[model samples]
Target: MVENEKDLKDLETEQSALSEEETSEQHDAPSEKNESSELEEALGKIASLEAKAEEYETKLLRVQADFENYKRRARMDAEAAQKYRAQSLVSEILPALDNFERALKVEAADEQTKSLLQGMEMVHRQLVSALKAEGVEEIETVGKPFDPQFHQAVMQAEEEGYEPNTVIEEFQKGYKLKDRVIRPSMVKVSQ
Candidate 1:
């Protein structure tokens, strides 16, 4: 009876040890699975944050480029404004100059009138000089090629000793403020 009891107790001890090992292995497997899942979740979050950061960086670059372009355009506009500052005043003075020129072309009736006309001519010359200094210039029309940019053709005629589309006469003068045409020349073009 004593021998049988000893064998039974040994068997129970072995069974209990095996069960404990199995339980430990089960716990380790689940823990490992949990750790792997947590690691995968952390990696996914990191990837999402990196993508967001890249998107923000791209937007920032675009805004910076847009701001730079705006600044360049504003600077160019200011320069253009400064360059053409006297355009309005020059436009106003041109008609008066034309009237003065027409008055100078009239024949004087007496010596007193001729002397007065001479003085007027000198004043006109001085005014022309002042305008020249301010970058005001007259457009050439007669005998040159007719250009719509610089000349307005009021009449077209077929004339001798002139090429087709050539300027034959200037009825009214044109003026330019720098490179820009303030008024186009009135002209007769040969067809």
Candidate 2:
């Protein structure tokens, strides 16, 4: 009877140990599930932050490119303004130059008139020199191929010993300032 009681006690102890181990395993499983869920949440937050940072970086690059383009355009406009600064003044002086040329072409009848003409010629030379220094120049017309950009065709004639569309004569002179035409030449073209 004592042996049977001892066997019963040992079996009861083993069963209690197994039940304790099962309770511990159940508690550990729930803890492991909680840890996995927390890790997934953290990873999702990290991905969202990374996406926002990437979007901000893309916007920064675009704004930087737009600012650079604006600066380049402003620089080009300043250069253009500096290059054409003398255009308006040169235009205003062209009619005076034409009148001077007409006055210089008249025949002097007396020595006093010739002396006055000589003084006028000196003034004309100084004006021309000033214009040349500012990059103003006359366009070539006679005996060259007619270009509508530099020459305005006032008349066309069938002339011998000249190619068609060639400039035969220039009635009014044309002037340019640094490759920009202030006025086109009034010209006769051969047909």
Candidate 3:
């Protein structure tokens, strides 16, 4: 009976010890919960930062592409400006060229005048050469088929030994600046 009583006391002490341990664990649980909430907040911040980074990267790429397009457009505009720089000057000189052609067709009166005319002819040739070097060229007219792009038919005539719609005579010469026609040829077309 005394041994049984000692065993009961021992069991009571063990039960009390287990209850105290459970209370200590309950007291530590709030700190573990705080840690878990902080970890969740940190993970959410990381996700938000990653989304912002992706958005910024997309904006950066769009800005870069826009800059490239702007550069290309600017370059093309500069090239066009440079290419057409001499257009006005060339246009102004064409009428003078027509006058020179008319003067060359007239017969010289005497030897002195003939020499003067020859000098003028040389000057005209030099002018033509200079214009040619600047990308000006005479449009072909005589014997070629009349084309509205380069030739203007002033008169039509039935001519033998010539194909219909062929240019038989050029009243005024035509010229081109590069691939573009500056003036159309004034011509007589054989019907």
Candidate 4:
């Protein structure tokens, strides 16, 4: 009968230990679940912040590109303004140059008139030099092929030595400001 009592006490103690172990396992499972939820929430916040950062970076790049383009356009405009600044004043002086050229072509009748002609010639040369310094150039028309851009054909002539559609005579001189033709040469073309 004593042996049976001892065996019953041992079994009860074993069952109590097993129950405590099960309770510990249940508490640990809830703690693991809480930790997993916290980890998921932190990952979600990180992902949101990363997306916002990328959006801001893209906006910054676009703004920087726009600013660069604006700067380039402004620079181009300023350069063009500087290049063409003398265009209007040069245009106004071209007719005066033509008149001076016509005056130089007249014949002097006497020694007194010849001295006056020489003085006028000097003035005309000085004017031409001044214009040349300001980037003015005379367009060549005589003996060359007739180009509509630089030469305007006022009359057609039949000349034996020249080819057809060639410039035979220049009636009025043409001038260019740099590469641009301010006035086209008035010419006669051989047919």
Candidates in order, TM-scores: namely 0.69, 0.74, 0.74, 0.69
Q: What's the CA RMSD for each of the models?
A: 24.6, 24.9, 25.1, 25.6
Model 4: residues >4 Å from true position, as ranges?
1-48
Writing each residue's lDDT as its tens digit, candidate 2 over 21-74 gives 547644643344577786876686578667656755765675576667767988
Ranking by TM-score: 3, 2, 4, 1
Candidate 1, position 65, lDDT: 69
Which candidate leads in TM-score? 3
Ranking by lDDT: 2, 1, 3, 4
Error of 3 at 85 (Å): 2.6
lDDT per model vs. reference:
0.84, 0.84, 0.83, 0.80
Q: Residue-pair clashes per candidate, as listed?
A: 0, 0, 0, 0
- lDDT tens digits, residues 12-86, model 3? 675576567557645643444577786876686578667656755765675576667767988999987777667
Clashes of 1: 0
Give the lDDT of residue 42 in candidate 2.
62
Clash pairs for candidate 4: none
Clashing pairs in 3: none
